[model samples]
Target: MGTLTTTGRARSVGALFAGVALLNTATVGLSTAATLIVAAGSGPGWSGLPSVANVLGTAAGALGAGLLLPVHGRRRVLSAGYAVAAAGALVAFAGALTTSLVPLLLGILLVGLGNGGAQLSRYLAADLYPEERRGRALSNVVWAGTVGALAGPALMAPAADVATGFGWPALSGPVAVAVLATAGAALAAAFLPRHVPVRQEVPVRAPARATGVARPLVAMVAAQLTMVAVMTMTPVQLENHGHGLDVVGWVLSAHLFGMFALAPLSGRIADRWGPRVTVNAGLGVLALSTATALAAPTAHTSGLPVALFLLGYGWNLVFVGGSAQLSRDLAPETRSRVQGTVDAVVWSASALAGLGSGQLFAGGGYALVAVVGGVLALLPLALLASRNGR
Candidate 1:
C-alpha cells in the first residue's frame, strides 16, 4: 500500500511537470502572436490589450479555482482549466482567421483563466512532498517550463509560415499551436491523482500570522506588476525599432529562459537561507533590470535582451520565494483556497500593469514603463526594511 501510494505521487508530479510545460508553450506562443496581430491592425496603443485580457482572465480563473479547488480535487479542476483554455485557443484562432479583435481578446481571456487554475498545480506538488523538500518539489514543476520557454518562441516563425501557407493570417498559426498545446496539457493533467497523498509527518509550526501572509502577497504583487509591465511592451518596442518576429522570438526566449532556467537554484536558496532573504535578493535584481532598460539606446541594442533576461530572473526569484513563504504553515483544509486567492490578487495587479504599459510606452517610450516598474519594485523593499526596523 505504501509503495502504491509512493508511485502515485511520482506519477502525479510527472504529469504536473508535463502539463505546466505544455501550458506555458501555448501561453508564450499566443502572447507573441497576439501582440503582433494587434499592433498590425489596431496600432501600438492597443498592443497591450492581449496581455490585459490574458491576465484578467487569469485573475478570474484564479478566483474561480479558489472556490472550486476546495470543492473538487486538483485532478478534475486542473484538467477542466486546460480544456477550457484549448477551446479558447480555438476561438482565438477563428478570430485570427477573420481579423477580429473581439473574439481574439475573449479567447485569450479564457486561456488566462485556464492558466490561473493550472498555476495552482505547484501547490498540489508541494502537498505531495514533505515540508523540508516542498521548495524543491515546487521548483521542479517550474523548471519544466524551460521546455516552453525555449520551444514556444522558437516555433513562432515556423508556425506563422505554416499558417501563411494555408492562406490564413500568420497570427492564426500560433493560435493553432496553442490549441494543440493546451489540449495536450489537459490530457496530462487528467493523469493526476484525484486526491493528493497525505504527508507522513506534519511538522509542528505556528499558524500563519497576518504578517506572514501579507508579506508574501506584497512580494508576489510587486513582482507580477513590474514583470508584466516591462515584458508586455518589449516585443512591441523591438518591432518598432525594425526588428522582425524572429528577433522578437529570440529575445523573448532569452527572457523566459531567465525566468525558468534557474528555478531550482532559487528554490534551494529559499529553502536554505529563507524566503525573506530570497525575496530581498529578487527585489534588488528587479531594480537592476529597470536600470538596464533605462540605459539601453533608443534603437535596437543588445542591452534590451540583457535587461529582459534580468527582469525575468528577478521575477522568478520573487515568485518562487513568495510562493514558498505563502505556503508555509498553511493548513491542508484551506491550502487551495488561500493559494488561489493570493494568485488572483497577484494576477489582478498584473492585469493593471499590462493594461497601462502600452499607454506608458506610447507617451514616453519604454523609459516611462521601466521607471514605473522600478518604483513598484522598490516599494516592497522599503516595506520590508520598515518591518525589520520594527
Candidate 2:
C-alpha cells in the first residue's frame, strides 16, 4: 500500500471527525427523546429503557463494526452504520406518533446498533495516524462528542415545538433530529475512500514483558461501566430531590463538558506519561468522584455538579488512555476483532448498569449506586497492579 500524503491523512481524518460528530448528535438526541416518550406513555420509572436499549444496540453495533472493519474497511462500515441509525430514528419517530412502547424500544435498540458502528470512528481515527500521535487522534474523535452532548438536549425544546407545529407529538422532534443527523453523517461518510491502504499495515507486536492487552481492555470496560451506572441515574436522583428539569439539564451539560472538553490534554498525558499511568490516575479520580457523590446528602446540592464533572473527566482519561493502549501492537487482522470484542464487553457492561441503576437506586438510593461504581472504578487499578507485579 502506498503511503498517504499528510494532506490526504488530514482530509480523511477531517471527514471522520465530521461524521462521528453528526452521528453522536443523532444518538444523543434519540436517547433523550426515547426516554421522554417512554416516560410520558408508561411512567417515569421506564425512563431507563431507552438507555438500556441504546447501550445494547451500541454493543451490537460495535461488535459488527469490529468484525467487519478489517474485511470491509472503515468507509463502508461507517456509511452502513449511519444508514442503520437513520432508519432506526425513522422507526422511532413512527413509534412516537403512534404512542407505542414496543416499537419505540425496538427502534431505540436499532439505533444502538448503529451507535456501535459509529463508535469505531475513534478506532479508525487512531488507525489513520502514526503510533506516537494515536492518543491525540483518538482524543480528537472523542472530543467531537462534546459538541453533540451539549447540543442534543438543548434541541429538545425546539424540536418539540417543531413537532407540535407539524401536528405531531412534541417528543417526536428529537427523533426527527436523530434521523437528520445520522443521515448527514452517512452522507459525509460516503466521501471516504473505498479503501485506505494505510490501515492495512502489519501490526507491531508488543514485547512479552509489557502488559498484556487485557489490562487496557479491562480498563475500558470498567471505566464505561462506572460512568454509565452513575450517569444514567443522576437525573432521577436530582429530580427525586426536588430539582427541576432545568437543573438536570445544567448538571448533565456540565458532565458532558467534563467528558470531552479536556480531550487534547488527556491525550497528551496518555502519550507522554504512558497509558498505564494515565489509566491509574483515571481510576483514582473516578474513585474519588464517586465517593464524593456518595457522601452528598441530597442530589439537589451544589456538590452534585462538581462530582459529575470529575466523573466525566476521569472517564475521559481512562477511555482515551485505554483505547490508545489497545490499538498498539496488534496485527491489522486482529485489531478490529479485539476492538469489537472489547466494545461489546464495555457496552454490555453499560447496558446492565443502565438496566439495574434505577432499580438499585430505588432500593438503596444513589449512595449505594455510587458505592458500587466507586468499587468498580478501583478494579482497573488492581488489575494493572497485578500485571505490573508479574
lDDT of each: 0.84, 0.79
lDDT of 1 at 344: 87
Best by lDDT: 1
Off by over 4 Å in 1: 1-4, 196-211, 297-301, 388-390
- Poorest stretch of ten by lDDT in candidate 1: 198-207
lDDT of 1 by residue, 202-298 (tens): 3323223433677778888999999999998989888888888898888888889989989999899988888888888899898899888888934
- Which segments of model 2 are wrong by more than 4 Å? 43-45, 196-211, 242-244, 297-301
What are the per-residue Cα lDDT tens digits for candidate 2 across 1-390?
124578767776777888877877887777766765665566555667888999999999998888777778777888898888888888888888888888788888888888887777788888877889999988998898888778776676788889999999887887889888888988888887667433545553332323346777778778888888888778777766686555666777777778887888899998888888888888898998898799873655477888888899999998888888877655555677677777887888888778777677767888888999999999768658876611
For candidate 1, what is the lDDT? 0.84
lDDT of 2: 0.79
lDDT of 2 at 114: 80
TM agreement with the true structure for every prediction? 0.94, 0.90
Best by TM-score: 1
